[model samples]
Target chain A: MRHFVFSLFTLLLACGAQAELRVFATVPEWAALARELGGDRVKVYSATSAFQDPHRIEAKPSLLAQARQANLVVAAGAELEVGWLPLVLRDSGNAAIQPGRPGYFEAAACVDRLEVPSVVDRAHGDVHAAGNPHIHLDPHRVQKVAEALAARLAEVDAPNAATYQANLKAFSGKWQAAIARWEREGAPLKGVGVLVHHASFTYLTHWLGMKELGTLEPKPGIEPTSGQLSGLLARQQAAPARMVLRTAYNPEGPSQWIAGKSGTPAVLLPYTVGGTPAAKDLVGLFDDTLQRLLQAVR
Target chain B: MQKRIAMAAMLAATFGAQAADHSELAAIRAQIDDMKRAYEQRIAALEQKLAQAESRPAAKPAPATVQSERTDSRRPAAGPASGFNPEVSLILQGQYKNMKDVPERGITGFWPAGGHDHGEGAIEGISKRGFSVDHTELVLAANIDPYWRGQAIIAAIDGTAEVEEAWFQSLGLGHGIGLKGGRFRSGIGYLNEQHPHMWDFADAPLMYRALFGNHGSYTNDGVQLKWLAPTDTFIELGAEMGRGANFPGTDRNKNGSGAAAVFAHVGGEVGVSNSWRAGVSYLTTQAKSRAAHFAGTVDDEVEGLFDGRSQNFIADLVWKWAPNGNPKYQNFKFQTEYFQRREKGDLTCATPEGAAATVACDGMLSAYRTRQSGWYAQGVYQFTPNWRAGLRYEQLDSGRRDFGDNAAYLVVDSYRPKKASAMIDYSWSEFSRVRLQYAQDKSMFGITDNQVTVQYIMSLGAHGAHKF
Candidate 1:
């Protein structure tokens, strides 16, 4: 009889162990952020990897299954996942993670957005109509998002409120210190000129005060016409940028071609957490990015 | 005795002194207990204070979740989450076709596929020549309320218009239960639910055209209930009830219950790069005087009716591969579907004079019991972000039949029909594509045609992402 009671007690604990909150994030950056905020109290899954374009993510069954059981959903929003996220949420059959619920957290909503367009034109290749949604690259913005996510995790899984609070306290202390160090190291990038593959780095450029020398795409999502490529080539001959920036996810052919012909160095930034081997987490993401920019300068 | 009494008195005096030391030890023990009680009281008070502090957080009303959505200037001013602004999008589709001229053009032995006409794509014998606008689809979708979301699609084909799909589905059903109602595509086969524009090739597979009347699977007024099992592997089961007003159904122009279907699917990932899915489905329906027969093939063919009960069975499988689960640069998808249909009823036939039959008979009846089956397999590979190529092979068999002396009605080699097609396409973006395709079609017995099609699909406004 005693053995039976002990076995039943063990079973109860095993069931409780599987009760951790499930988090479904649209990008790896948000997944890393949730891991820091939720600690061991949650199991977080990212729909897209660091080496994939977030704007054109395909909806897979595994992703839908995650959404169906997710207690919280963190996304970049502002139409960053406008192509896929809505459908996934609708099909997930899980109402807890739907938009407008406390369980839904959009990172772009946590920060001051950049380049709010005065007009909307989808045909011109400016895909995101609600301004740019790639706001995760800015450390200050990421800190703000992390604070919101921590509070959301507490609200969604109230039983673990204390755990979330402790994790938040620890993360904020370390993240703030890291931010200050990054600002000091990135000081040299303040007026450095750069050409980009797309407008994906507007937040990075704004935060570091880097000069934007236009983009190789010419128009946002459209392939550059020969005329547009030649125009960029001719302009580069006159006033070349110090660095041509492209994320690991974006195709490298165009940026490398421009770099080769225009005599500029092309630098691949860790656009999100785990985009490169060195960027295994949120802090490493920024450290690697800043280090690359500084290296290009040297 | 007096001396002993004096010694006893002295012993008593010593015992009294030791008793005094024992009293001092008891007093020390009491003092220690009093200190422990005092410390316990202090700790309790501190714990109470800590609990109160934790219970009452700083009165900062958490950053209103509403403020996050309002920050985006793109949203309509002051219109929150449920503001009735539905997403609207327009699709423009056009195509050019070139095929060899033949004395007759028709898919030979498709019996019940002559009636329903719903979406895009050509049927067996209706292939056109030259340039034409195939279809322009208009789509509108939005969440109706917290519990429901609705979508409507209208297709404009040639000079006619049709509602391809219009349905409202439950949004709040958790644990994988889904409820959908209204006119929509039935999810019976792997490719049955996808629209023509989403197909890898410009033309429908020969098997699909023979079974679904050319535009892939036909849509119907219906309601569906689906459940996804709570397991690690992807398992789904669904049942649907629809008004059988179209081909193979012969709604008989009546409104009563006409058709019903049930399906089951299971899928799981093999590793980091490979994923696979397989499904089995069954559909049963009754057709009252269903209209059918070949039209203007070799001669003016006549229209006939098959009044009976029909049943169809479909088995399908799909396998996808992408290294490390990243398919942007390269991926391969192989899919195949096999279907068998059984019909039992009375079929009425006519003479070669067709609708103009004068003497040979206006009312010719034959006991009809027929079984037909077909299968198609296709593979698509995306070698680059913008370039892809696909190849497909299809075959159909006109199954065992007893026509009751109407041997003249049997057309072509009833046992076999085969077709092979290959295509390559380039996508400008996720929303736009141009494709070139060629095929050798022998759906008709002893007749072959080499066909070529150049097609383009362009989208404007909002387009939702496709599901895999």
Candidate 2:
């Protein structure tokens, strides 16, 4: 019995040593970013798929199992995961990735957020007091988060610090070049008035200089009513938007209805990595988004 | 700067060509305003980044040095003003129940367990014939420190308040070990740990009512220890020691623990949509002089007292499925649990002091023993975002009863008990729900009750996520 116990302990230690860093990301975009920074030195897992709403994901047992062995947990914090992340962290029983620890990294904390509400009230529907958490759409904010994530990786897995830094440098250089090209190619999209299904596209429109006409839903998380849809239609007929924008996961009914009534195009943009077939990575996400928007305008 | 000046020059040339178009001019002005706001935001972001960088430590240190610094700075020096303020939430619940007015209610084929009974005008356990307040709970939770987290749930039934749960859990216990102490719901079965508000139906299963009395759950003051295995699949083992002061056990004034329990659970996901968990548990306790009231065959009330050892074995399973791992619109969950109990002890049955004894007790103590078992199965489906429907069926068997030498006075029944319930609930938001439930309850051997209940539950403060 003693020998068996000793062998079991040794086996657990060997398993722990195999993975230099186990990263659990609450969203796919963060998982993609972690993979880019920790190349070969880290094992990354995404708790939610690109086709799932981040705000409403359940704290399933599968996620808890992943969190139990994770050396780092990446989340779009600022209350984006307020509903489920706390429960996952509390129940994981893994001390390494609890809040305020070195292993826990929040992407939104690394950048300035938009749409911060001064008066926090549910009367305005489900409003995040810490501002909009869709910071990944802005490539600049993604770059900022990359720097912080790289630093965090180095802190947790010091043996791979040099590798992490080198990977960060290479990723940043390529990403900056891609951003420049996208900006130049997307100049035609400047000052284009668009209607969005939700405020999820706030950072994206802000980056590309698109004007947001209105939202389909009257509030942040409330479903759109027929009365509200007709109101938006009336406003659209008076000052027509060029297109209606929605993510791949959003319900297509409202956007299609408005687009049909206004005689405009309804565009589906890939909100994250793997959201669409062409959006297989970070660069492809923006490329596909720009391509879809350009197609709509043409 | 040069690009802006050139754009302004181009706009001026356009204006010179189409000066008569007022709508075009207004649109150009709006575009210019948008550009101005965008630039201002960009500058502000850059300034904020600069400030952050300036505030960071200047020296680039090695990883070892950084680790030491982080260890030293485990707790934040300055917390938010409301950091000490706990997350407080209140659940408001009321229900209108329509059923027969049975003055005294008890499941027929089961031994009467001891727990909280209804307060005031509640003649039929938790509900009456008309409108009544259900269990309204006020919960407060917060991280006590770097090493501990604490929570308290106070429940108000009718006009009286009771502490439902108050516990502190260790937050920094590594290696998948967790420690908790205080009064808490026993983690014996899947449904036992969840509060009534989280139940899919308005009422609990008949099996629970038989085992833990009308309260439908077992709570005790105890210390619990749990260990989670480090594996891809979820495996957890837990053990608890508690003061056995509630149903199926009695408060035997002793120095050590009177009740002990151990449980193990295994779970995993199948493909991308379905997940399942299965668990088995065992509990043992000692009861000294437990009191119970039962109706005799002649409608006379009989008093029974028991002193003995009781043991329970339970098995539970839950399975859930959502399309593409997204449950925003549709999902389904099926859960089932089975409970078997065995008890051996000396039982004394007699009439109350003021009542006449239809059956003579003769002051005789009989060596009585019994083995009983119960099981329930339920399923809930959410077809839309705001609507859900559920159905549950439960049955109990009074397997064997032996009242040696006192069989005439302590009568045993051969009848089995069962109930079937169906419910539909709609939620306008995550914090509010209204449910309509109907049940055909035959748990009380001779009576088959058709019951209807309409319940409304509203949460007034902090929103809590339900555990899977």
Candidate 3:
């Protein structure tokens, strides 16, 4: 039948289109990094986005669909996506991207890691002591992820290895320059004190020699209760901490409460790109984040 | 750590006093013990790092300071279970309305055609209300270990507030067998097990609301068992004996009848492709009839015997398609479900024409039969991370019935009428929804009622399980 022939033709076209390597990333930052390295040859998507709280994303039907179609799945492992991604992948039956599979990419794997906690206690909050999952905020580590992704893309798409290599080189050069500029900008801010949620920005804070006073969350991923907030307020009133830092997605209520109870400014920073207009991309994300922190501290 | 150990000892003492009755909190403590072990391992790792750094040469003093600072950074604001998390969420929305026939309907008015009648005919003053807490709910969930998980839910509206789900789950059983018991939602169906906290819509679907009753067949006094098969598939079988719904103000010792229900469900998903499931359920009970005493506008109080039964079967399938790495956005998601039901027996008395009967069925008995089926297809597409749209079309029909073929019979008008309904809804974000839907219904059996409703939904809470 003519319909059957048309269907076969469409199927053939789809098969041909599938030649472009498919790569899945758990968040936009990693997806962006993969795209920069793989260029036109790889299709990338994130399990969560700049606007979403990576900690509490729901594994909905649509997300499962993406997991099903993925050829290579990337995520900020170390328990960042532990809440739902595991269920999604296990239910998706995507053996290709199952944990420990070659197609499975844990972006944190490449880092000379920090935040490797010696203790694992949930009494404070759910802990992913493997390492801090938020590493892309550090330019040097982000470059490492880019290099790994390029190598992986080359292995999957050998014909486009040269293109991926060139892309990685360009990305590294640009990243190196940006890091130098940030270092220079951060020269005078060493040991500057601040408070935040968990160790979400440990790499960035450590890079700038920012002395962390404490965290707003009594525990990782837990909200600041009234009693805890009051305690922090008491501490803030006494010590006059330079700044209170928070991600864009964190509830404004706790931050607002701390600000009202204590004469302190809560610096709402863009935790990822596209979270705010000022944080349009990786470079803009850091630039805007550092600028906001600098302004608050000053 | 000492405080925790003392508390654990005190809890163990309390549990020893009440040996038989399982204390949910005690089980949670055991689970926390496991998490404590994991935390201790991390602590050991950090201690080793610190020891190594401290033992290093004087030339590496800078590195040691950095290492100490990094260790300090890993510490959380909360000491242990203190001020660790405070969850909050917000939702605001509105409802637009247009009612046919009556310009105004109160909460107690008789329902127009194609609407569900709860305890009475639809009431008055219900149509014009703009927006309210349609889907706002709060959740605090914690897992102590493999054998215990604790959860609490609070809604903006409904009956007196009480703990909705408080139970302990056991996973260290034979062959992946798990046990659950306590005040929990009966795992009667795919949707029922998925608490209202997990629904995509502000209101449940019409078929579910109709047959199962609004609030969807929630009852107390139950136990459940789940078996995970080797192929990564799971089967759940459960039962419960609880107080039935009929006369609102009856005591458990009086005309209350024992109701028995049974159900089984199995399903799983593969890759990013699709998920499928099938289920069957049956429930039956005896009904007690009574005559009017103080309010004798009707017939004499008659003691009668009646049996009621209901059976349901369902098949469902879901498919999601998105290319790898792009999870923030999905091109499409598809879900479809088919359900069927059978019911028999009735308790109704004859009434004269042109006259409404407040009391008519004295020692009068009637028989009735019901056959129904329906299906629905729903999909959602995320245009961007902050925005998404959804569409759903649901259809249900209760076939025509036959009573005594006499006008005097109670439910005479509804003895042979069919009921059909359909709803379409769209939702935005994880917290809000706006819905518009229509239905056509006919049933004097008190089982047939229909009406159109424009509903709005809003939610506040930590993330709930997804519909995938």
Candidate whose DockQ is highest: 2
Evaluated on CA atoms against the true complex, candidate 3 attains a DockQ of 0.05
Candidate 1 residue B78 Cα shift, in angstroms, is 11
Residue-level lDDT of model 3, residues B329-443, one tens digit each, is 4445566666666655654443322234444554466764556666666666655433445666665555544433211433212233333434445544444555664444442
Q: By summed lDDT, which 10 consecutive residues of candidate 3 chain A come out lowest?
A: A117-126
Which consecutive 10 residues in model 2 chain B have the weakest lDDT in total?
B58-67
Runs of candidate 1 exceeding 4 Å displacement: A1-6, A224-227, B1-68, B71-83, B101-105, B116-126, B253-256, B294-303, B350-365, B405-413
True interface contacts reproduced by each model, as a fraction? 0.22, 0.34, 0.04
Query: What tens digits encode model 2's per-residue C-alpha lDDT throughout A1-298?
Result: 9999999999999987776799999999999999999998999999988888888888788888889899999988867887888888877889998877887888877766666554567788777766678889988778888998999999999989999999999999999999888888888887888999889988788778777889998888877778988999999867789999988778888999998888879999999998899998899999999999999888
Query: How does candidate 3 fare on TM-score?
Result: 0.50
Which ten residues in a row are the worst by lDDT in model 3 chain B? B105-114
Q: Residue by residue across A1-298, what tens digits does model 1's lDDT show?
A: 9999999999999988778998888999999999999887889888888877777666666677678778889888777887678878887777777776777777776664555443456666755544578888877778778777888888889988999989999999999898778888888888777988888888788678787787888678765556776787788767768988898877788878877887789899988898889999999999999999999999
- The residue-by-residue lDDT of candidate 2 on B14-44, one tens digit each, is 9877876777888999999999867755664
Each model's iRMS: 11.2, 7.9, 11.0
**Structure candidate 1, residue pairs in collision:** none
Instruction: Tell me which of candidates 1 and 2 scores higher on DockQ.
Output: 2
lDDT of 3 at B402: 42
What's the TM-score, to 2 decimals, of chain B in model 2? 0.81
